[model samples]
Target: MEENNSFSIKNWNEDDRPREKLLLKGRTALSDTELIAILIGSGSRNESAVSLSQRILASVSNNLSELGRLSIPELMEFKGIGEAKAICIAAAMELGRRRRTGEALERKKITSSNSVFEYVQPIIGELPHEEFWILYLNNSNKIIKSAQLSKGGITGTVVDVRLAFKDALQLGAVGIILAHNHPSGTLKPSQADIQLTKKLKTAGDSLDIKVLDHLIITEKAYFSFADENML
Candidate 1:
């Protein structure tokens, strides 16, 4: 069934309204467009909220992960999404990401690169820029803290080697896992990436801290330096 674009949801049958649909049929029964319409709240002068949401989802091929990556300004480019509406959408997306990351307790032990991905992916996977993070682990290989060392552009970040070990030394952490996201979606490490890993590992060595692995994270995959014997 095709909806009339010009008609507001107010004019539609109550059953067709996204809010009503969620109430009657439950959340799983609502489409992605309906879920997004609930976030943006309203549409432009000539369009219904549902129609505007459909256009927004269509812009990203209806991939929620892709939609999660859009910057606030990018969302504001939509016809009816002003700063407030765009902020609402971005906030909702972040909540969804955090909900996934909240399961980090289940992965407190750093067993493998895949285990690292499960805990860290939700925090950095969908970002539009670079973020360098360090996961500090006790001698038992359990996480002590995960902190962002630096935030920078798509090309790279300037991570201070001394700062990398500061938290580890304070927390009595003997193991460190380096991680950063690539918004460009490339898994291959640049010379800068490899060099930084080497430099940080050397710095950690002097402190008796083990640089266990360096992971280059993308939205759906990761490259592990330890796994590849590059460490």
Candidate 2:
């Protein structure tokens, strides 16, 4: 207990060391702290790597997503976590995020608001400011390409209608979905949001491109203009 907490990995029983345990039982057998300890490589004189990792997780409420949000500097503030360890943890988290994004992009179709939410959430939902994106889709509604059209302050972003349509044309897309994130996490669409949806829909109509939906996304939920009959 206390002995385990104070001792370094070298002093731990072979099976209890993170790397050894992982090799013996597979990655799934290692706890979050153990996996993080492995990334950290070592610990300070006052605590074992596992114990230090436990403290790091505690600082973020044991939420891995929250941990993933930490910058390298923020991670380095933890005892026993130097620049190398901090970068390792941050890089690992980023790789996981990219993997999820790649998986979302590989889906065959954009069939529902929920599907849109899953695809774009990793890209923009948790942003601290507003950003606008357009998903260009083929006639079958499969996403051909997605692009960020603008980024702005907390309240809103400017959407360039012509540029968005130009990208859609270049992609040979027959339809598009508009998306933006509200950093404040409120699902309610602002009056500006309503107006933008109407405007984009009208513009797409002129180009013979359907505006499939406009989604106002937050970290946890989303409001769909089409779902509410607002599009």
Candidate 3:
């Protein structure tokens, strides 16, 4: 989608815009689109950097994984994405993927929602699309195994409850923690999120496995169903 607005990012309020927001509120405060806009720096004559970045992301169904698969030529096909902009995007996406891969090679214990965020943020926090993951923990709350259950859950309904718990049974995990990232940078749990957490909790109960928590992760913050007494 080509943005018809000719206004620049500068036209927005200093505090409200991506560049200034990052400076004032820190990097974690900006959304995925805003981070991409910062990398590309400027948009074409008819689009703001933010708009061009949004259009680029929209082309990939807002999946950063899809965006990472694009070649420079493929990214350049967009109206405002050029060779330089494409290169910048390509580099950043590569770094993000590498960082996630490196982190996933190790295991971490889940002591709290904040701990879950620290371990999982590099994997999903900055993506343009939603992802659901399950952390299967041994009796001591140490992570023994992890799996990606679903690729899309912006509405919080795409995860399969059976699939999420199947590995817990195989791994002989005593407990499980549910986690998924919100690309929109909102920490509020949707009704679907609540329902999904309840559904999974109910299923885990019959198997004698505990559902410890469900964390809704964002760029900087997270919402914990267990912490809020929602689960």
Q: Rate residue 29 of model 2 by lDDT.
A: 95
lDDT of 3 by residue, 107-176 (tens): 4777788888888777787777899989999998999887889897455438888877778888999999
| Ranking according to TM-score, highest score first | 2, 1, 3
In TM-score terms, which candidate is top? 2
Worst 10 residues of 2 by lDDT: 1-10
Error of 1 at 103 (Å): 1.9
lDDT for every model? 0.89, 0.89, 0.83
Q: Which sections of candidate 2 miss by over 4 Å?
A: 1-16
1-231: candidate 2 lDDT, tens digit per residue:
345553555576432599887886899999898899899888887787888999999999988878998999999899788899999999999898899899998884999999999999989987889999989999888988888999999978898988999998889999999999999989999999998888999999999999999999888789998899998
Lowest lDDT 10-mer window, candidate 1?
6-15
True-structure RMSD, every candidate: 4.4, 3.8, 10.8
How does model 2 fare in lDDT?
0.89
How much is the lDDT of residue 50 in candidate 1? 85
